[model samples]
Target chain A: MKAETRRLTRKSDHTRQRILDAAASTLANRGYAGTSIKAIADSIDMQDASLYYHFESKDALVLEVLRTGVVLSEEAVNAAVSALGEQPDPIDALRAAIVAHAEAVLGMGDYPRANVRNFGQLPQEIVSAQMSHQRRYGKVWRNLIEAAMASGRLRQDMNTRAMRMLILGALNWAPEWYKPRGELSPGDVGRQMAAMIIEGLLATGAAQPVRRQKQGNGR
Target chain B: MKAETRRLTRKSDHTRQRILDAAASTLANRGYAGTSIKAIADSIDMQDASLYYHFESKDALVLEVLRTGVVLSEEAVNAAVSALGEQPDPIDALRAAIVAHAEAVLGMGDYPRANVRNFGQLPQEIVSAQMSHQRRYGKVWRNLIEAAMASGRLRQDMNTRAMRMLILGALNWAPEWYKPRGELSPGDVGRQMAAMIIEGLLATGAAQPVRRQKQGNGR
Candidate 1:
């Protein structure tokens, strides 16, 4: 390729990344309905036409930002679990995934945070566009939970679907209250949550030990 | 009071309720930014001026709806716990509160769901105005958790604050995926969540049980 063409391509890619960064931060702070293309362009000091040069429309740009969010979080979870070598304990892998997810959404950057914040407030078309990414991410957690259950360590009496939702719900809600400068790090929060979820709040062998015979499909 | 005056007062109150109902459903579905005063007025076929007469502005209208949401959930939790009567088991009371909260947010109506959905997207001033009610509601859970802990039946090593936040997060996130017509009722979701939280996901006497000695406030 010609030297000038190569330079132009690099500059264009940089511009696209800048636009995405701005869009992500906007979407993270203000939700989907609150973000606008004009505001995004203005934040980056780019003309609307130039912004459109990179992306077709507001939905398309937001779609890419959200898609990146899911990818980033899924990658974070996969990396954390993979870091635990071959045939690691399923419970430890689950804990690592939880911490990685918390860090991704809380400390890593705005892309994952945007996905966490906007899950329920998107247009039907946007939700449809993001469904596959979300489904794939869901599968990641499902597998983690299933692996733990298969190890015969996790309880079998509860509904696994509800368990997954509850775990993700707790982790996803971190962005609402997590402050980077606060006393607790994302990992700290995740560890505490994982402990509470694994051991529960009940004191073992205490008064009112309510354990019962395993019930069928308790949901 | 005169009968004519009383009749007019009743009619005004009824109209006020109609406006609030429309506002709650719209806010729950569309979120704060997506909901407009004009759209809310149009939905109920009320003039914009009439809406303004009932609520000074969009923020004022939304503020009332969210206020009702917190109040309803708090009341539900309070009533559920109160039904246990004096000297009831703290764990039982906590379970009742959880079930009531889930029912309020999931099955009762849109007001609580609106509060759950729009919590992170509200403007600063609205958040400020609602802080007292939220704080009061927080205190209710804190007291319940404290009661459970005092009974020496709950874990002493975990952070109580994190425990409350995780429980609320899991419950509050129900609006995102809970279908009213689905197989699980609100009470069922709450019961399953309570069971998972109180007993945890660990199988009793399973491999890799990670119980530890009492440690310093493990935040």
Candidate 2:
């Protein structure tokens, strides 16, 4: 009886995964406000009633889709980090993680794209869940940045939050202009992005803010 | 007779500006696919038919709105550049341009927001026109980055296009997370972003591409 239950659970999980894939594509193409439950169900050739057995409502389904996007995104970043192995240079790990992240978010995938596109349109309940996921993602990057700083591989006095945002912001915006066959692939763009950010943060000499002080107004 | 014609033209231009402002807000909120001529006209308390007198079609109206966005964006960049005055430092000019851009994009205004939101969904003719405007915007940024490089203020080997994209991409993405009452204002965010990017590219002594080489693959 236990074996039979385990089999059933596996099948159910497979079906849920299938639904998420279909929903992500639909949501990416049509957005939150334009997509309907009927359309999502139709994409998977599943009945609306059956879909409800798995998901309580459209919001429930969308929330899962967003969760999947964040999960997949984290997995890519992890893979990039793992490539560094034990005792890796923190700055190098950051570059690999950022490049993988750029590829995952900017390449031919629907989940991350949908998350960035429909973030503003999701229902309140779903939004809370997405925001929590986003916060977790932010923390991961912050830790990487802190590790880099601790290792003296980057500027020691940098603000992690601002630096993380600047890096992720550029990566997230890649889909806006990232042509598949264009001169730069997502990976190439990622490397370039990582280089530029890391170069700026190098503490060749102890860094200071570069904003020009008004000569006449010096107090 | 010439004076009378000039007065009529001024009145017509005023009405056109009014229509574009309404359309920009509507499009920003509802997106290009979700918005309609009737919606924009309703926003301004004007009939859809009369709206046609000012814009030949929805495409024409959207095109004009985009033009206004580009023009306003250029003006903001120009203001930032002018602040540096004659004999400006390249890095300082870049910083000022980025800060101004961040404020314009992430501020209370809706035209630039509408442009980014509705860019993909615009009609083909409108998109072609938008592309040209975008290209011009790219040139302005490229010029700043190139000037920085020429002055040895930034890394000489870095691709100007990539650097420009990284700077502009982060600035453009600010609207996603920039809260008016947040810890940092849009201008402040812009400055931080500039410092981050510019710092990464500083040509101090020797620099290395911050990427991890695969272990056991000794070069």
Candidate 3:
């Protein structure tokens, strides 16, 4: 609340953001075994001690990096779907959300990529925290899926819960194969998958992308 | 071949199969760090020395275990598609293949499950060998998807290569959330996904199962 305290808080927040960015890049390029506290600190031109002063340990830092991506993914998907506004078909909302997710993950440079690559390798101390965020993320996707199914726009007989997992798995796995400059953009890849999963690739009638698909949706 | 040599060859093959089977179950249950040559040997009541005689190293053993599942998946999907006969519909063939794959990965216990669970953690030496089999496996799925697209059954506008990757990603991720004895059988999960993917959930008019869908497609 005081002037000096406010200045310190702003600096602390900036330092945290810088550390996250550096760690995300390092972990993405180097993977779990190759990434280290010193490497991350060096990336940001900060001392290892200073880095630790802001975060407790390497596990704690890595967890924060992962949490940042998951939280961002959730918020981005929510925003994409909500932007659809009233009278948006449930199926269309789901597709836009999928595109939004794919872009957020692929478009955001290292952090989400690292989360996918090193997730299975993270120490339990970090992974447990990351998993909580992941579950919450899953919950949001599940709600969208349930809404789509309940609206009779998606199949009711099929298990929506199982379908939700498969859909997420498909989208989540995009980073492993998605090339930023490849044949298709991330939004294109997401739309392709959403059409395949939601509409059945068998038909030519997959739901059209909302005309107002938000800008910056492509990786 | 001489009778004595032929008999010995057959016995050697049997022992190799036994060792591979034991290794797959152990790795699936205990994970990479927890699994060892000694533990695999113990599971099958063989001396570690004899196990070494067959596998050379833990990496070799794990690689063979993974290869077994991928090889099985390829064969099963091939058989399913081939059984569709000369005039079979492409969508039906793809559906049957999807069911075959799901049953293989999620139904048959630990080998494939281990391949999915511990793939990211496996040492590069072991993983490199496993990946070759995976690529071959991918080729088979790609062919099916391409055939369906070429037939104008699946949407022609979507890229088949990208579609293949997304389809497999969803199916492969099944083991992470699938329960062997859950509400849906592995066969059912496969069928559900096949329908959701190939037929699109929005259509109640999608092709009904070919009733003659290959008998005993389940594990």
- Candidate 3 backbone collisions, by pair: A199-B200, A200-B199, A200-B200
TM-score of each: 0.88, 0.74, 0.79
Off by over 4 Å in 3: A1-19, A22-54, A117-128, A205-219, B1-54, B118-131, B207-219
In the predicted model 1, the residue pairs found to clash are none
In model 2, the clashing pairs are A199-B200, A200-B199, A200-B200, A200-B201
**In angstroms, how far off is A192's CA in candidate 2?**
1.6
Candidate 2, residues A17-54, lDDT tens digits: the string is 78888888877767776667888888888887788767
Per-prediction DockQ, in order?
Answer: 0.36, 0.21, 0.36
> lDDT of each structure?
0.84, 0.72, 0.74
Order of models, best TM-score first: 1, 3, 2
State the lDDT at B41 in candidate 2.
88
Tens digit of lDDT per residue, candidate 3, span B17-97?
888888888766556655778888888888888876666677777877788777878887898888989868888888889
Give per-residue CA lDDT, model 1, range B139-214, as digits (tens).
Answer: 9999999999888888877667887988899999888877767677787788888888888888885323222222
| lDDT per residue as tens, model 2, B1-219 | 232344445567888888988998887767766678898888888999898777767877787788777777888898889878897988789878987787787773788877766654455667787888888887888788888888776765456777777777787777666676666666567766766677762334343333222222100
